[model samples]
Target chain A: MDLFYLAISSTFVNNILLAQYLGHCPFLGVSKRIGTALGMAAAIIFVTILSAIFTWSTFTYVLRPYGLEFLQTLTFILIIASLVQLVEIILKKKSKALYNALGVYLALITTNCAVMGVALLITRKELGFIEMLVFAIASSVGYALALLLFAGHRERLQISAIPKSMQGTAIALVTAGIMSLAFIGFRGMAA
Target chain B: MSKTQHIGATLKAGLWQRIPPFRLVLGLCPSLAITTSAENGLGMGLALAFVVTLSNGIISSLRNVIPGKVRIASYIVIIATLVSIVEIVMKAFFFPLSEQLGIYIPLIVVNCIVLGRAEGFASKNPPLISMADGISIGVGYTLSLTLIGSIRELLGSGSWFGLRVFGESFEPLAFLILAPGAFITIGILLGLQNLFSRWRGEKFIQS
Candidate 1:
């Protein structure tokens, strides 16, 4: 019951993108086409989970034992940056089709705060290993869901007649605003 | 161009021509997340400015020494170090604001503006000019965040920087400070910016 609630809450009510505001860069940047949005979502999910696992262990085994909690920001970023590179190189050699799909976004993930944000959030919430895994998957799914929905809107928006000044990002932001308002309705569900 | 003239152009560019959040559209996360109040916005902006300015200077000075193949890795290390310093300082001194800002303080490690300026401007320029560019962009970013924060606070809570701007009878919109309000505020602000620039015949920023 607890895990179910955690999943549902993170996926909807306390959405990492909508409510918590962790990864607005990609939410706005790559949500233009559903195809690219799908790709970015897959990449984020993959990298975020892997990085979370690594960062969690590093913090538990290294940072905590040594009382170097303050060094977490520096350490986690370095880990994520290098981890993305490693994954990219490994994917290129082993899985050609997968590489083609997620290749571009993998590089961009190094800077995407969602991965780092999840890692930090796990530590801050002091979730156990099992709970941490569940939270990571749930949060990435939330991010993916939001991106796909926004992309669908953006695709139709391409055909609509918006004001010249409010055409691109401005209009997209307004749409996101409305979507966020709708998401707020989920607050009651989680509670 | 002469050295001083070049520096002036860089400063001008950072301040208005290519400001981070507004013109460049970089660093959207922090701009959107912490700008619920003027104080938080200014605090976040200043924290970022300090990191970016110092990182730019350090990266500029070591540009030649860092290998091209691994310059990004090197830059991340430099930036991460500076951000760690900021995180520690904020915890030590500005505890309340630090708590309010929360994970964002550490998440600065991944903020594109810091790394963007490092890769784009600092690596190519001399240390002094890079520092000036950092300062200009910092001020520009600070001003933008403060502006957005003020708008949100004044309308949402009928206050600005924690002081009541509107009287007790004033019913705050309450929406302007929430998540949706942030998106709409930035969206409308972006539209207005484009409208003004179009009137002046300036190029439209795609982001």
Candidate 2:
């Protein structure tokens, strides 16, 4: 039940994009089309979970035992970079369709910060291995949820009449504001 | 638009022509997340300035030595190292502000502005020029963040740097410091900028 609350709170109330602002690059970059949104979300979900797992163990076993906690930033970044490369190579060899769908986004994930944010947040909260996994999954799910909803609105927004000046980032930000307002409503529901 | 552009133009471009967080639309994450108060925004901006200038200088010097395919990785390694240094320094010297900023400080490793400078300017230029690019862009980022921070601080808390600008009975919106408030604040500022540019008959709002 505690794990369930953690999942719900992170997914809804503490959304990575709308609430925490961890993954704004991906949130705004590939969110124009629904297809691209799904692709980006899928890639983030996959990599965020894996990077969390790897960074956690590395910090716990390697860094902590050796008193290298100061190396957290450098070590976690290197871990995330290698993990992204590994995921890219494996996806290409095993699943052509998935690889094609992910495309440039896979490479971009290495710098997405959501991956690193998950790892860092995990360390900050000092969650156990299982709790870390739960947070990662929930964070990514929240990213997907917000992306899909924004993509849907953006699809309609593409056709709708917006002012000339507010065409791209300006309007997207306003939409995000409204979406964030909605997400705030979920605060009392779970946590 | 010459092959060998003047150094002044590059610096000018980052300052006003293509200022970030507003014009280039890069680094919005920290711009929004940290700008709740002027102090936090200024702190974040200076940290970025240190990281960006140092990494750009290092990357520019090593551009030829780094292989083409691994350049991105190399750039990130350099950036992460600088960020780690800043993180440690802040922890030691500026513990209060460091605690205020939290993970966002370390997350600068992946900040678009830093990497954007690397791929866009630093990789091709000499170290001297790239260092200028970093400082120019860093100053632009600092000013923009400070502007946003002061606005949010004054309105959200009815104070500037906690001085309480407004009278005691004044009701602060309070929303201006929240997550939704951040988006609204930046969005309105972007629109207003574009609107002013259009009034002046200039092409603006690149993306």
Q: lDDT tens string, model 2, B1-207?
A: 663477788788887778888887788889989899999989999999889899999999999999999999899889988998999999999999999999999999999999999999999999988988998899899989988999999999998876889898989989889899999989988898888888888876565
> Which candidate leads the pack in lDDT?
1
Superposed on all Cα atoms, model 2 deviates from the true structure by an RMSD in Å of: 1.5
Chain B TM-score, model 1, reads 0.97
DockQ of 1: 0.82
Give the per-residue Cα lDDT of candidate 2 at A132. Answer: 91
> Residue B76 error for model 2, in Å?
0.7
Off by over 4 Å in 1: none
* Model 2: CA > 4 A from native: B1-5
Candidate 2 local distance difference test against the native: 0.91
Q: What is the lDDT of residue A4 in candidate 1?
A: 94
Q: Which candidate gets the maximum TM-score versus the true structure?
A: 1
**Candidate 1, TM-score vs. the true structure?**
0.98
lDDT of 2 by residue, A45-141 (tens): 9999999999999999999999999899899999999999999999899999999999999999988878898899999999998889999999999
- DockQ of each candidate, alpha-carbon based: 0.82, 0.81
